[model samples]
Target: MPRTPRTFTVSDSIVVAASPEAVYGQVSRPALTGRWSPENLGATVHGTGGADRETYVGMVFDGHNKRGPARWSTRCTVTAADAGERFAFRVHAIGLRTPRLRGPIA
Candidate 1:
């Protein structure tokens, strides 16, 4: 007998019964994502708009992530932070211990 290769496509979704503010409160803070994510272990906000204050457009955050047994961090800058509307960031650098390199990450 011969073995057959396997291919799988996985997709998942969920419907949260919450208001926009509630959703935004959870999503805007990078430090809180670790509570729900598997690969992401959360982040540490740098200045001004730290996790304690409101999110802003120029806030910098160090994102910590892990996969299987490997761990790494990424230097990210918040590009958009519209309360209860939109939130986004850009990965500027990456490294194992610290993000020594700098630039727009692919």
Candidate 2:
């Protein structure tokens, strides 16, 4: 069997009532990542520095809905960054989908 090639595009923006540095910190912060997305439990950094970049390991918490506490893991690549200005990452799952979730700080 062969899998069909699928492509999808999506974009979104958010305005944060904080400084750009604050916004950037929140984006890089592992604990704060979940606050942005409910599916995200938390993240773990595997390296150091922003120029070279690092690995962000995010976990998904399982809610007791129809299913029990199911834990899932996902990896994101910090593709783009500009200190306290902008940042971007690509979420890897079954397919390579670049989730360009970005916003400004207030």
Candidate 3:
């Protein structure tokens, strides 16, 4: 059987009554995401420097995530990081195993 490629996109936003610097301080730190994000369990910085290091463009790290009974890790790389402006990272699931779902069972 042939497999079809799949693409997924997720977006979220929150309004915080705080300075940009304060918000950036929390968002830029990968270790802190677990505290706020529901899906993200936690993250650890890779390749030395510091465990809770600030993310910069091109920085690589690993993220731990969980969804129901399934848990997985992802390799992430920071693509954009502008102080008090924007911080974005790309995630690639590691050792992911997709279950076969032929038709709508439900």
Candidate 4:
């Protein structure tokens, strides 16, 4: 039998009782995400001279993630970084040895 491709989507949101700038300060800092997210262990900024606190378009970084005993890294590049409004990065998992986990047994 031929295998069908699988797709999954995950979404999450939280309400913070603070100014947008304050919230952005916390969320945009990749170093702090590990404390809140169970899957994201942390990230390391790539290249030289660019401070980890400074994020701009085209900036590159590596994200470390864990799912139970499985661990992997993903390369990310900043696509948008608007203070107090929006910050986004694109993740690439190419050339990674990611494990394929089977669904729960019936």
Q: Which is the leading candidate under lDDT?
A: 1
Q: Write the per-residue lDDT of candidate 4 for residues 1-106, one digit (tens) a residue.
A: 9999666545677888899998877768776678778898777777775445577888876677788997776767788889999888766543233323323211
| Pairs with backbone N, CA or C atoms under 3 Å apart (clashes), candidate 3 | none
- List candidate 3 segments past 4 Å from native: 1-9, 96-106
Q: How many backbone clashes does candidate 1 have?
A: 0
How far out, in Å, is residue 78 in model 1? 0.6
Show where candidate 1 strays beyond 4 Å.
1-14
- Ranking of all candidate structures by their TM-score, best first: 1, 3, 4, 2
* Cα lDDT tens digits for candidate 1, 1-106: 8998565444565688998789889889899879988988999999865678788888888999999989999999888988887788888899997977887663
Provide the overall lDDT of each model, using Cα atoms, as 2-decimal numbers. 0.84, 0.48, 0.73, 0.69
lDDT of 2 at 27: 72
The TM-scores, one per candidate, come to 0.79, 0.53, 0.75, 0.72
Please report how far candidate 2 places residue 9 from its true position, in Å: 2.7
Please give the RMSD to the true structure for each candidate, in Å. Answer: 7.9, 9.8, 6.5, 6.3
lDDT of 2 by residue, 21-88 (tens): 87777775544566776556555444454323432333221111111364444445555666686666
Q: For model 1, what is the C-alpha lDDT against the true structure?
A: 0.84
Q: Would you list the rank order by lDDT, best first?
A: 1, 3, 4, 2
Q: Show the lowest summed lDDT stretch of 10 residues, model 4.
A: 97-106
| Top candidate when judged by TM-score against the true structure | 1
Off by over 4 Å in 4: 1-11, 94-106
Error of 1 at 29 (Å): 0.5
